[model samples]
Target: MELKSFKFDLDERQVKWIFSPLRDKIQVIELLMKIIKIILVDDKLDSERIKGKVVLRVSKMSRLFFFSEDKFFSINFPFLVFHANKDLSFQSKNGNKVDNKVTSDVLGLLASEVLLSSDHVLEFADPVADIEDYNSGFWSLLKELLLFEDGYIRYDYDDKHVNGQRHPLNHLDIFYCSGSTFKIGLRQRITDNHLMDLLDLETDSHFLERL
Candidate 1:
């Protein structure tokens, strides 16, 4: 029997509701891609991004979060952040010491049970520069996700190279990753004392009292 194609208005609420039966198997992937696509264009506008953080705030918990970026890739995970240099675009961050990924699936890593626990607190100060683990060879597939840029985002799932190996790390198939990527950077972590005041990151006291 031929089935009619259900129209989607680019609404997630609709997608979740319409596909509830098959959600568990696909929703996580879809949700993950949704967030990724948003982060590519404008992370702040993505509700999933806000929702994930809200989950953190409401839990009254402090969780560790960090991110990494390079010419070939970008990655971040729950608190344990590492980065490779643009010049050394082929090297995996700390491939010898540790694999900082928290989970196997991109979706699971971003919004995982760890967040459910209220005992988390942001740890370390500029860790990538001084932490041993951050410098160690990358390990742990749980939090691992290949950074994709432009429309050619794709993973082979078969091309995962050994840590510290010189090769193109393109195991993630973005064509099937269900989304596209944009230029990602480490702009979110900038914390210069001189720069902080100029950013005006928080609302004044009057705004706080109202909330």
Candidate 2:
């Protein structure tokens, strides 16, 4: 007796809906890039250029790390995987080529969770300063900041695990708190537009007048 084999291919529409998480992730990446660009261009921020060609990187588990060159600051996507059934096509894949289209999601959801953490201090390096001195004052401030004794914005998202009045799915953990109980819950998940708006707000407090 001979056995028959078959392979099924997904159409464009199916590919999109099925892998929407990945698509969302790609969009998130794009949004992050835009924010970074805005920061770099703003003369007030005086953002320091990443020392190497790589400003962002993905680990084997799909978590993303940005501004790796700087020890005190970074943006992390610790849980952006969306796996389902038995699909492991993108398993352990660590590259920036997840999609080719401007907003592509060719790779369907490849994990079971999605989270984002935007961690950074208000201070940036002096653009004209030598590379070696990039972390000068910022590092010292970061040390104190690490103890939750300073002010900073840390946007975090988590939908994987939720409990009543505890770990809200969407919340902003402003300033570093020693305990995780301090959280400001939001009614909806944060979007690229929200982040963009935040960037504008941070850049120019006057922007609020326009809104």
Candidate 3:
């Protein structure tokens, strides 16, 4: 589903505040749209699971807002992919023993490229790893787009910390919303730390477009 298809509710007061001093809001949305485009064109999902999907667009412009009754269920996205980069090594959530024979994992592939039709595709588990500063993997680029301060990526997990468990630091923080089907743009409120952090970085590097 496109941005215009969803029914959106706006807070005029918040809308004005969000649009005034903030910049890069469009850049953030554009990045999200790129991710969504990959998802829409990718043929890695099961057909039965991809049906009955809806896209909800919020009217706010702080950080990109993505939510769904089911994880990645909106816009007919297939199962969500959970990944972790630990000890500078790449692996899936299940702690699949990464042998030199296996090079690319789900998270790495999704972040790097999107395949419309291929031999293998990324699959999603359930729940996800705990929230941690995930600034070490492909998710780091995405996390930077989501929050100005710092955050971790989270997708799916079983939470059965038994033997042979894989814990990834970088993950996406998208989850399920079991509630009424309504549209609400969601973005984190900017903070002094966020502004100062960006200012400090501005003196050295231009990670994003000037707003």
Candidate 4:
């Protein structure tokens, strides 16, 4: 498999949703990268390694109850896996511990699950099918995979030496699959902040009222 790595910065406007309110107020600029490893495996599977700032945005809003007023709560912020060849970026408010390694691991698990449940090829080759169902299905599955565990994943950090110098590293070796299956493996690290922030944001609001 050929893995291509590319890095970029995040846009400043989306930083507020990622960092905690108690965090430092200084400007945090983070560089986000995506390492897409393409392989012609049994079912045309592509493993993606996404590394970047863990800023999340609540793109949609839902009501608390079936007939309740429309509230700004009950939002879903799927992990944004920026394509290595795309022109998207993110900037942080406080640039402390802005390492992509941690975030990459989180995304690796997400990517794995998404690929596992996604349909690689369609039976019909209709152009309209690609536009409507194919694209929507892919994104829907991706979002479910990211928010599968309600962002309850864990990480372990360790110190390593390279060229006689010690460096800090984060590893995401454990995760819950389908909010049921538990799996542990050594893979690239991705931050859990993105998932945690989503949960925090969601739980703060009354979502059932909007549903």
Candidate 5:
């Protein structure tokens, strides 16, 4: 049986803030155990199950963020591919055998990429409730008139129109609901990058676009 491994170098600050808080230590060995438990089920492990491993090394430079109220930290980490074995496979939710060797690596890459891309946009708090309070009761009326999430404001768009003209059209444009408020147009052409860029601008843009 061939052995496969995934390895990445995390920032020291991230190791202290994010990984350390997840458990006691922030070393590669500690984080590896946490990651394994998160990605694999208990029954999937065996005594001689192809010797799989995921390793995270600590790099020199790192950035960390602390959310006091949230009681969590964010870290920026880098990855390096060590040994990528091609013989390993995993059973998917559909009972189909698929390649599993790259699963951990892919997840690590995605998390790193998201942190690198969205670090700027996550600095602010949600503005909907704040603005609603200042409007004295206009927002309260709109809350009763519009749909919302379980405890948040959300819009439910329906596509049922006999002539196909009454449907809520989604686009990539920004809609200014008020002087300081805006809504985002969601259409098929708009990409996640575009949305993130608009969000980073600190404008009150809400995504009303559907997939």
Candidate 6:
């Protein structure tokens, strides 16, 4: 997907707002599910369980949303990834986990390998891990959205570790190359509306058209 195909033009300020974390865990989860439903419905994809296939599942034990089985999405995006720095113990419906020292697991959306031909490609398994925890043992199949120059999109909520001016509490990174980074500092927290708008921009204003 090329950036030219996008319907909305994103300014610097808007980008910052869209990527920051403005809501609590429950609110974030609600927003994510809402967007996922929109995407699946818009593409006419099936999320229902069929032949023992599970598309979406919410784990109360871990306080996370994920899919237990593969082939969930019609597209190559097999997993959805979202992460928060809040502690699992403190996370609840009433209030958010606001402590910066607490380490929490990532709620993620991951990508699968899209084979271009009949050739066999390496297979990868999805696992729940912390941020920056990549295993070098297996080749990663986690490539999420937009084939724009072989680039994928990622959102981060980093309030746990803020070292002076080095790391911003909330920021967005849009990059296509390893060892290269293009970060945008978010002045305000990101809301569900911003996320939906972001998707609309990438999906050629489908959400807006529906409205």
Q: Pick the candidate with the highest lDDT.
A: 2
lDDT of 2 by residue, 1-211 (tens): 1211112232333223322222233444444333333323322321342231212222331222222111111234222333245321221122222112211211111111231232322122222122225323323322222232112233456656666448777665543435432566666665533543343323333222221
Model with the higher lDDT, candidate 5 or 6: 6
Q: Identify the runs in model 4 with alpha carbons over 4 angstroms from their true place.
A: 18-211
Q: On residues 102-203, what C-alpha lDDT tens digit does candidate 4 reach at each position?
A: 234324433343433557533322322443352334333333333332332334343432122122244332223344433332233433332243345344
Candidate 1 regions with alpha-carbon error over 4 angstroms: 1-30, 43-139, 143-211
83-190 per-residue lDDT for model 3 (tens digits) = 233111223333332222222232333343333234453421110111112213334333333344311112222134312313322112322222412222212233
Worst 10 residues of 6 by lDDT: 67-76
Better of 2 and 5 by TM-score: 2
State model 3's lDDT: 0.28
Which of the two, 2 or 3, has more TM-score? 2
Best by TM-score: 6
Per-residue lDDT over 28-144 for candidate 5, one digit per residue giving the tens place of the 0 to 100 score: 223432343333332334434423222322223211222221122222222222222422223322232222333332234324544335556442122334433543433333232
What is candidate 1's TM-score against the reference? 0.19
TM-score of each: 0.19, 0.27, 0.19, 0.19, 0.16, 0.27
- Candidate 6 lDDT (Cα, whole model)? 0.30
Pairs in steric clash, model 2: 19-108, 19-109, 81-111, 82-110, 82-111, 83-110, 83-111
TM-score of 5: 0.16
C-alpha RMSD by candidate, in order: 22.3, 21.0, 20.3, 21.4, 22.0, 19.3
Better of 3 and 6 by lDDT: 6
TM-score of decoy 3: 0.19
Q: Model 3: runs farther than 4 Å from truth?
A: 1-3, 6-51, 61-106, 109-143, 146-211
